[model samples]
Target chain A: MIARVVVVPRPQVADPQGITVARALAQLGFAEVRSVRVGKYLELELDGPPQDADRRIEEMCRKLLANPVIEDYHFSLEEATTQR
Target chain B: MIARVVVVPRPQVADPQGITVARALAQLGFAEVRSVRVGKYLELELDGPPQDADRRIEEMCRKLLANPVIEDYHFSLEEATTQR
Candidate 1:
C-alpha cells in the first residue's frame, strides 16, 4: 500500500518560511499573492495488509512524522500498482 | 482564490531526508515501511480573478515554487471561503 501524508503547521502557529515565500512572490511581482503556508508531503510505500496499515500509519505519524504540539497531519492509503 | 501546490523531487533525484525517515521508522519497528519520499506542500492565497489566476500560478511555479532541473510541481485552485 501507499500512504500519502501531509504535515502542516497549525493555523495559529507562525510560519517564517511561508512569510518569506510570500514576500519573495510579492517582490517577484506576483502582487496578487496575499499569503502562503508551507508544509511537508510524504509518500510511504508499505508492505502490509490493509487492515493493519491504517493503524500503523497513524502511529507513525504521531511518533515520528508530525510534531503534535505545533502541527497537524492527515493521510490516505491506496493500493500500490507498481513495485518500487 | 487559493492555490495548493505540491512540489516533489524527481524520481531519479536523491532524497537523503526520505532515507533517514525510512531508517528511523524501521528502527522504531515499522518494518513494513518499504520506502519513503519527501516533498513540499504550499498553500497560496491570491487576490485575483479566476481566469487570470491559472496562468499566473503556472508562471509562479515555473519561476519560483519548483526547481525545473530537480523537482516537479502541480497545483489546484479553489474559491476562498474565509479571509486569511
Candidate 2:
C-alpha cells in the first residue's frame, strides 16, 4: 500500500520559514503574495493488505508519523482494495 | 482560501532523511517498517475570494510553490462557494 502523509503546522506556531519565503516573494515582485506556512509530506509504501491499511496507517501517524502538539497530519492509503 | 501544498521528491531522487528515519524507527522497535520517503507540506491562507482560488493556486504551485525539477505538488482550496 502507498501511504501519502501531509503534515501541517498549527496556525498559532511561529513560522519563520514561511515568513521568510513570503518576504522573498514580495521582494521578487510577487505583490499579491500574502502568507505561507511550511510543513512535511511523506510517502510510504507499507507492506500490508487493504483490509487493515487505513486503521494501521492512522495508528502509525498518531504514534510516530506526526507531532500532535505542533502539527496535524492525515494520510491516504491506496492500492489495497483489489489486492487479494 | 486555504492552500495546502504537498511536495514530494521524485522516486529517482535519493531520500536520505527518510532512510535515516526508517533506520531509527527500526532501532526503536518498529520492525514492520520497510521504506520511507520524506517530502514537504505547506499550507497557505490566501487573501482572496474562492472564485479564482483553484486556478491561482495551481499557477502558484507551477511557478514559485514547488520545485518541478525534483518535486511534485498538489493543493486544494476551500470556503468559497458559501462566501457571500
Q: lDDT by residue for model 1 over B1-84, one digit each (tens)?
A: 999998989999999999999999999999999999999999999997989999999999999999989999889999999866
Clashing pairs in 1: none
Residue B76 displacement in candidate 1 (angstroms): 1.5
Candidate 2's C-alpha runs over 4 A off are: A80-84, B49-55, B80-84
Q: Residue-wise lDDT of candidate 1 within A1-84, one digit each (tens)?
A: 999998989999999999999999999999999999999999999997889999999999999999999999999999999866
Residue-wise C-alpha lDDT for candidate 2, range B1-84, written one tens digit per residue: 667777777888888999987786677665556788998887776665567778777777777777889877777766523433
Each prediction's TM-score versus the true structure? 0.96, 0.79
Model 2 agreement with the true structure over A1-84: per-residue lDDT tens digits: 777888877888888989987786677655555788888888776674568778777777777878899988888877734333
Q: Give the DockQ (2 decimals) of all models.
A: 0.92, 0.61
The list of candidate 1 runs beyond 4 A from truth reads none
lDDT of 2: 0.75
